[model samples]
Target: MKIYIVGSVGSGKTTLARKVSAKLQVPHFETDNFVWTRHLKGDIRNEIEVRDQLLQDAIILDHWVIEGVHKDWTDPGLQVADQIIFLDFPSQKRVQRIVKRYIYQLLRIEKANYKPTFSMFLRMFKWNKYFEEQMKPEFIMKCNVYDHKLYRFQTDKEVKDWFHQIQRG
Candidate 1:
């Protein structure tokens, strides 16, 4: 099973992907690993070539769950996914989650996959706003193209219910 989870920052894409991966015993990949490279200075995005190659490798996995907010760069994975989960949580809820996660990461209580900085936190808020105002429409439009494979959830309760259904299946 190849699963792709897409949503705005803090929409629980990574959390759901991790849960699903554990439940299914499938490998999981985060787009952050592909998109950003660690350096002594800070985290930097990989070149387009490197990013694309990494994404290709993950998509070719026999069974995998990949999660990210990236859309255009993840088109290939979407095309190959058996299921595409769209976490459509409300903007207020997402922002709350983001703030909570950022604080945890800042305190070193939670391990961040990428460098955690105040600037990054601010950028996340900006991204969230952009997603709400612009990218969401695009995401909806693109998802329509894969309606058969799309499973969308707007609340944590709905996500839990869906996860239970998957477990039962």
Candidate 2:
């Protein structure tokens, strides 16, 4: 089960990937890990060839679940994915999650890959807005060719029910 989950930040891609990966016993990965070299201070972007190669290696595997906000560089994963989940939640809902997650990270309730700063917090909202205005429409256009394998959900219940159905049948 090669599943690729995509959405804007705070759309719950990581949570859904964890759940699906656990239920299916498939390895899970984050495109962020490929896109940026994680560091204690700040993440550095990986070279394009390095990022592409890493993604290629992962998608070529037997069973995996990968999630991210990445688009252009991830077309190969989209092409190979047995299933693609897009959590196209409304902007307000996503913004709320971003706030909640940032708070959690600030209080050390939740771990973050990078330092949780006010600047970073502000950037998340900015990214979300950019995603709403640009990324979503671009993704919709790019993913139309993969409609047969794509499963888009706007609500948690709908996603859960659809996932359960897939697990059963």
What's the CA error at residue 139 for candidate 2, in Å? 0.6
What would the per-residue lDDT of candidate 2 be over residues 59-100, giving only the tens digit for each residue? Answer: 989999999998898999999999899999999999999999
**Clashing residue pairs, candidate 1?**
none
Q: Which regions in candidate 1 have their CA more than 4 angstroms from the true location? A: none
Predicted model with the maximum TM-score: 2
CA lDDT of every candidate: 0.91, 0.92
Clashing pairs in 2: none
Q: What C-alpha lDDT, on a 0 to 100 scale, does residue 164 get in candidate 1? A: 96
Worst 10 residues of 1 by lDDT: 36-45
**TM-score, per-candidate, Cα-based:** 0.94, 0.95
Best by lDDT: 2
lDDT of 2 at 104: 96
